[model samples]
Target: MIVTASSITFITPQVATARAFYERYFDTWSPFDCGWYVLVRLGKEPDAPEIGFMEPRDGAEPFRAGGMLNLTVDDVDHMHARMSSAGETIVIPLADNPWGHRGFGVIDPAGVVVYCHKAIPASDAFAPFIQKGPDVPRGA
Candidate 1:
């Protein structure tokens, strides 16, 4: 099957709070508010991945904890500094990972861990495990 677009919907009782958190931190994204649900698009492009926030319904439960959202950025340091200056909670400090990334984590209002990172050269231990797919772009 051919996939046209991609998105992840998070169930939360505090939809407005979640929406405000994302809007404040992730400025590049544009949010489409729909009262009970909000869809935040990464870009103006139609195929851009959307991060959605929706209210729990019909006995559905909200996400309790341990949810992670990985966001790839051009500059991890700048992003970290910006969030830090904004008084956002930083659960993980900026550090280089052996798996070829420099990143930090921030917990949102809904208890979701948002990891903002940038790609870097992998260490010897993880280099061999890094494989490039046919359609995947190089230097990613």
Candidate 2:
């Protein structure tokens, strides 16, 4: 079976700014704005969560302990502009990669990492995740 109803958590030092970064850049993304936790929907359907923000931790438990999330965008530059305006720290600038993608990075509340990026040629930047093994064929 396929995976459904999953949330990738990002630990952050600042929650409000992290929340703002997503609200400005993403397209049609609705996030559950709880006081401590926030869940951002990245899909067209009613129950598609692209990313999420957990409660803040005392230390870098999530990032140092190994946790991060990614959400591909249509325009990385546009996102950079908005996020910069929102004063979200730019962990990395939008640029082309040797692996074939134009992307950038941002740190969010609860110590979570929110990556906003787009493909250089606007193609399958998420090919690694979308691709399945023998159990799930490419065309199936």
Candidate 3:
């Protein structure tokens, strides 16, 4: 299992500005930029980060979405199961989605929406059903 305690989430208005700020002022490195998001590298091993800039679409108003936290986990299923067994409140069920990834979500004690995700492997395409749990290919 590849797990790490890292990632800093932010609520920004202009993603471009945030990207530029991180790249120039912070000297942060980011190779991938996509719709509504940009992944910046903090020059660390095991692919961990110290900070991040997130621009929510609904950030224009005074009231913003609550329980907004992004997280990446090694095994979402196992983690969800364990947490559920411990009486965790699951707002979303364990399933795959079109965006890719097979996982579920739950509101923490602090009412934070923690999305536990596991990257799906491509090799597992041959499986009976390809749930959105994992977007990357899994290998034997």
Best model per TM-score: 1
Q: Against the hidden reference, what TM-scores do the models get?
A: 0.87, 0.61, 0.42
Instruction: List residue ranges in candidate 3 displaced over 4 A.
Output: 1-67, 121-140
Q: Judged by lDDT relative to the true structure, which candidate is superior, 1 or 3?
A: 1
Q: CA lDDT of each candidate?
A: 0.83, 0.65, 0.58
Clashes of 2: 10
Clashes of each: 0, 10, 15
Which pairs of residues have clashing backbones in candidate 1? none
Arrange candidates by TM-score, highest first: which order? 1, 2, 3
Candidate 1: how large is its RMSD?
Answer: 3.1
Q: How close is candidate 2 to the true structure, as a TM-score?
A: 0.61
What ranges in model 1 sit over 4 Å off? 28-31, 134-140
Residue 137 of model 1: what lDDT? 59
Candidate 1 local accuracy as lDDT? 0.83
Residue by residue across 58-119, what tens digits does model 1's lDDT show? Answer: 98899887678999977889989988998989999999999999999998877789999999
